[model samples]
Structure formats: structure tokens, C-alpha cells
Target chain A: MSETRMPALSRRRVIVTAAQLGAASVASAFLARHAAATPESAKEWLGKLAKGEAKAGKVSIKAPEIAENGNNVPVTVAVESPMTAADYVKAVHVVADGNPNPGVASFFLTPACGKAEVQTRIRMATTQNIVAVAEMGDGSLWTATRQVKVTIGGCGG
Target chain B: MAADVKPRIKAPATAKKGETFEIKTLVTHEMESGQRKDADGKTIPRKIINAFHCKLNGREVFSAKIEPAVAANPYLSFFVRAEESGTYEFTWVDDDGSLYKAEHKIAVS
Candidate 1:
């Protein structure tokens, strides 16, 4: 499976590169148009907030490994920051990949927060990955992901 | 509008100067996600508190953009540094244009 997939992936990459070289502006515009679509997936949410990629560090999520009740799972997200006017966390976006809607919540913070941390209860449709992305005042994005097994799905499932 | 919605806040009344403290808040609301169906098989319209804001002495402290995935009776916990003596104002904006407000005073020694 790996051998067959490698060539196919490389071929697609070559095609993409060719297209980019042929019409770099058009390709970028097309990509931007698609990126503007209503984001419903966890990766899309990260892309939207992080502006493309996010590093997996300086942020952490605390939650149970297994949630007996999917209706209300307590989660906390914290980012390492001094909370000073010069350096602080701007916002943190929580996204549950397996939920009906990927976005759980977005917390906006300021230096007065003193700590770049937030706790909230979120609903998950099923067992899935909960991703927390933190946007720093310096425009850097950090992320953390945790998987939770839900015995029963939320949304009355 | 959400029925009997009330905002509850937990914050210290006093703190050492420049000390960090925790603040927990909960507002009662159904947070109907519009994905549920009633007994008659009709969709229950979505009604939720979409936004929450916290301010200290007329300056923004923290805020959140809530979504349907947030459970009913949304609860939030965060931290604030005691810079000075002031009132902390909390506000929740419901989908039906209802504003739920609460306040707590903190003294920085």
C-alpha cells in the first residue's frame, strides 16, 4: 500500500507544482477562495485561525482520556505566556474533530488575564480528537491535541 | 429568550497586590443547538448565549466566542491579576438579544 501510494502522491505534487508555476496568482486566488468556505473541520479551523500551520508546543489541553458522558466533558487549555503587555496570549480556539460542529469555543484574552488559561465544558458527538490552538501576541500559533473516548455520544445519540 | 437565565460568578473579594486569581462563571441557558427535534419531529430552533465578556475598570480583561458545542449552563474559568481595586463586570449575550450581566468586586491590597 505504501509503495503504490508514494508515486501517486508524488505525481499529484508535481501536478500541483506545475499548476502553481503556470499561474501562480490564479492558483493562489483559487486557494484563497476555497479557504474562505465555511470551515466545518478541525483542520480547517486550525488553518483559519493559525493562517496555515501551527506548532505543537507551548500549549496544552487537560481532559479525561475517556469521557463516560459526552454531553458535558470538562476541558482546560493553557498556554505558556508571561501575560505581560509585551507578550501574552491573544486567543485560544478549541475544536473537536468528531463533533457535529468542529468549533467548541474561542477565548479572547488580554494582558489583564494574568494567565493564558481557560476551562470550559464541551459537547462531543463521539470519541474524537480535541484540539486547542493558541494564538500568541507575537502572531505565532501553538497547538495541542488530545483524544477522548466517549462511551455515549452527545446530541442525544 | 431563555427562561430564567441567571449569571453566577465566583471571584475573590480581596487579593494580594499583583497576585493572580481564578474566576469561574456560569450562566444558565439551554444552548439549544438547533440539531435536536421536538416530540412532533420539528426542529427546535437554536437559542444560545453566543458571547461572553469580562471587564475590569472599563478595560477589557477576557472574552469568549461561544458555540453550540458548549454544553448547557455554560461555565468558564479563567485567571485575572489583581492590579488594583475595581469591579469586574461579566456579560453574556444570548442569541435572542438578551444580555445577562453580573459583577464582582475585588480589592488589591
Candidate 2:
């Protein structure tokens, strides 16, 4: 009986993998032409901003755990930086994983800003993860993510 | 383009030298996301403020690249260090090449 169960589980896993591959192909095709945003597209955007892979640290995103309305959800991103000419945050890019368009906003900073923090409101199409990546003056990248449960969709009229 | 478009700013009128202070700004615009359909089921064209920046005197302090995922009547808050007394000029650039600006004066003691 144990041997039979093992074989069945392995067969199920193969089928699941095949299905995932099929879905991924379809997603990629849609991602190229459609204006809607997906996890893959969001990752691509982050990659462009970071100019490399971003490590998860030194950045924090402040957002509500639950949002009753997806129309306007407040989000704040803060990075740990000295804000000095020698060491400062260059920019912070934000993306919403479940929006029609994931490109939320990008804040460009200078040493005169005196802080590596910015706050803005965003529109969420559904419950999704908000990711922020901060680029440092030394070309290093840091990232953080937060999930918000959006009760209502925001893209529709 | 939307009507009644206006930019409002919130900044300290005075601050100590080398002090870091927060600046908040908001602009009135529909920010049509181009994802919505009209009664005839036609998609509305996207129109939004695409960029914003703040300059202290003649130097750049902060700027932002706005996107469609931003909410309507976009609001942003950032920080600035008061090195010396100067006028802060805030500018918002719209999709149709319209520029909206506002100014605030800060005194550093």
C-alpha cells in the first residue's frame, strides 16, 4: 500500500507541474501585449529599477493590513540611510502585484531631502502585495514587501 | 485634461538651521486610469500627472515619477533639510504637458 501511494503522489506532482508550465506560457503571452500587471511584470519592473537583484533588508513598507476600499490605500516606504552625500538613497520604486498596472510610483531623492522616506496613496485592484525597492548611492539595492487585503476592486469605473 | 486642477502644499513656515522637516503636497485631478469604460463601453484615455518635484531655492530636493496605479488627486509627502532660508518651488507635470506649480517660503533660524 505504501508503494502504491508513493507512485500516485509522484504522478500527481508531474501533472501539476505540466499544468503550471502551460499557465506560465499563457501568462507570458498576455504580459507582453496587455496593460494589466502581473507578478512577472512587477518583477521585471523591479529589476529595471535595481539594475540588479535586490536583497530583502533595510527597507520597510507601511500599509494597512486590511483595506475596506481599494480606491485609495495609503502606503509609505522608508529606507535606512544617512542622507549624506557619501551615503544616501538614490531612488525608491514601488509596485503593486495585483493591479491593472503595477507601476505604482518612483521617488527620486537627493541628499538635500535629508531622509529616505516617502508616502503616497495607491489604487489596488485586489488583495495583493506591495513591494518597494530602494537604490543606494553606492549602487546597492534593498527591498521590502507588504500584503494588503483589499475588499473591493479599484480599477473599474 | 480635467477642470478645476489645483495644487496644494503643506510645509513649515519656519525651521531651525539644519533641521529636517516634512512637506506634503496634493493636486486635484481625475487621474483617469484609462482602464475604465464609458456608457458606450469605450475605454477612457489615460490622463494623469506624470511627474512632480520640489526645489529649494534653485537646488533640487526631491522628485517623483507618477504612474497610473497612483490614486486620484495624488498626494505625496517627503522630507527636506533646512540648511538656509529659501523659497520652495513645487511643480507637477501632467500627461498633456501642463505644468502646475506652487511656492512656499521657509525661514531657517
How does each model score on lDDT?
0.87, 0.90
TM-score of 2: 0.86
| Sliding window of 10 residues with minimal summed lDDT for model 2 chain A | A1-10
lDDT of 1: 0.87
Among incorrect, acceptable, medium and high, the docking class of model 1 is medium
**DockQ, each predicted model:** 0.64, 0.69
lDDT at B58, model 1: 85
The numbered model that scores best in TM-score is: 2
Candidate 1: regions farther than 4 A off: A1-40, B1-3
DockQ of 1: 0.64
Instruction: Give the worst 10-residue stretch by lDDT in candidate 1 chain A.
Output: A30-39
Candidate 2: clashing pairs of residues: none
